[model samples]
Target: MIAIIDYDAGNLTSVERAVRFLGEDCAVTRDLDLISKAERVIFPGVGAAGSAMESLKKYGLDKALHEAMKAGKPILGICLGTQIITSFSEENQGTPCLGLVKGEVLCFPDDMKSPEGEKLKVPHMGWNNVTVLKDHPVLADLRPEHQFYFVHSYYPMAKEAGNVLAETAYGLTFSSVMGRDNLIATQFHPEKSGKPGLALLKNFIAWKP
Candidate 1:
């Protein structure tokens, strides 16, 4: 079974629906054994990093996630879910995170502006094209610049450039996908991203790395 980590801080129904649509089994749970034993794990999060981390710790899911990494199980994190996988986040006033990936989650600069000199918006809502940087199994057969749904003010700056699988531009370029070993995460929400997104989800389910 594929387990979706339920730390009580994510919008998980959409992910569940998408996985089921692919004709696979998935479960939402905070149980450590379930997460550790699953064929794959989805660690999705929304809301503030501080609160989300709180819940993860409360249920010992943080430790369980570490265990998943050590075992080399395939795991995917979505959006804020993506952020907490990193070392730290500027959100919730400097929250320390999972550190699974060598990166920091950062808010878009308040003074960030487009090259054309227009002020860029925070929370980069709506559809944006992801430029696949390195070939990743999750993006193996995807077309270039396929659009994905994104809704966040923060994005990760991966310390290890090799882990960056794709990028997207807001006021400037930012990492959209990061993958290393059995771990992968997306800053965009595949559940709501339509065709390309569903294709991504399907690819993820089939990915063995």
Candidate 2:
């Protein structure tokens, strides 16, 4: 069974519903034992980074999650869930994260000054298009320019370009999906992205560690 981690963050049910729609077994629990035993673990969140990190620590979930990942199980993180996998985040007073991936979570630059100098809206809400950048199992059947639901102001800047599997253009292009070993994360809400999203979830479920 797949495990949808429960940590009082919003959108957990939405994720669970999507999993059930795919006709798969998923358990939503905070129990570390269940998480460790699951074939694939999903960490979904939509909240303040500092608060989330505190909750994770309070529940001793940080260690549990790390143990699961270390055991070479496939893990997927969404939204703030994705951010926590990174080394640290500048959001919510700069909280230290899971350190599973070598990167930092940051907000859109106030000056809007990249080499490209692109200007777009903040939060990057609603449906946005993501272009495939690298090949990965999570994106097995997904095509370039697939539309996915997104709702966030902060984005991930991967330290290594090779870690980026998909890019999406907002004020400027940013990492939409990142993959490293058994770890996979997406800034976009695949659970709400319709058929393409469901396909990706199915692929994740069938992914081999």
Candidate 3:
């Protein structure tokens, strides 16, 4: 069974529904034992870094995540989950994060603008395409034309370039997909995205790494 981690960060049900639609057994839970035993774990969230960390600590899911990573479990992170897995976040007056991946989350500059010189908004919402930087099984089926849903003000910057899997441009290009070993993460929401998104999730479900 796949464990969809629950720490009160919104967007849990959508992920659960998507997983079920793919005919996979999954549960949104805070049970440490259940998380540890699950074949794979989906750490998905949509919220502020500060409050999310507080909830993670409150439910001890933070430590559980570290344990799962150390055991080489296939773990997937989305949106807020992707942010907190980094070392720190510029959000909430500089919040410390899981440090699972060597990187920092940074907010987009206020004066950010598109290449065409058009002003781009913060919290880059709606559909955007990602440029795959490195190949991985979870992203094998994704084509250049495939776009994913995004809604975030901050984006991850990995310390090691090798850790970057894909990048997307709003005002500027930023790391959109990152992974190492058994862990993979996406800045976009595959659950909310259409066929391409579902394809990514399906690839993840069968991904051995």
TM-score of each: 0.96, 0.93, 0.99
> Of the pair 1 and 3, which is ahead by TM-score?
3
Which stretches in model 2 have alpha-carbon errors above 4 Å?
111-119
Which ranges of candidate 3 are over 4 A from the true structure?
none
Give the Å shift of residue 49 in candidate 2: 0.6
Ranking of predictions according to TM-score: 3, 1, 2
Candidate 1 wrong stretches, greater than 4 Å:
none
User: Scored by Cα lDDT, where does model 2 land?
Assistant: 0.86
Model 3, range 105-188, lDDT digits (tens) per residue? 999998998888988898799999999989899999889989899999999988899999999989888889988999999999
> Candidate 2 residues 1-209, lDDT tens each?
99998877889999999999989999988998888788889999998889889889988889988998889989999988998889989988789998888898888866564357656567778998888888787798887657899998899878888888888877767888987888899998989999999999999988996
Q: What C-alpha lDDT, on a 0 to 100 scale, does residue 10 get in candidate 3?
A: 95
How much lDDT does each candidate structure score?
Answer: 0.89, 0.86, 0.95
lDDT for position 206 in model 3 = 98
Structure candidate 3, residue pairs in collision: none
Error of 1 at 22 (Å): 0.8
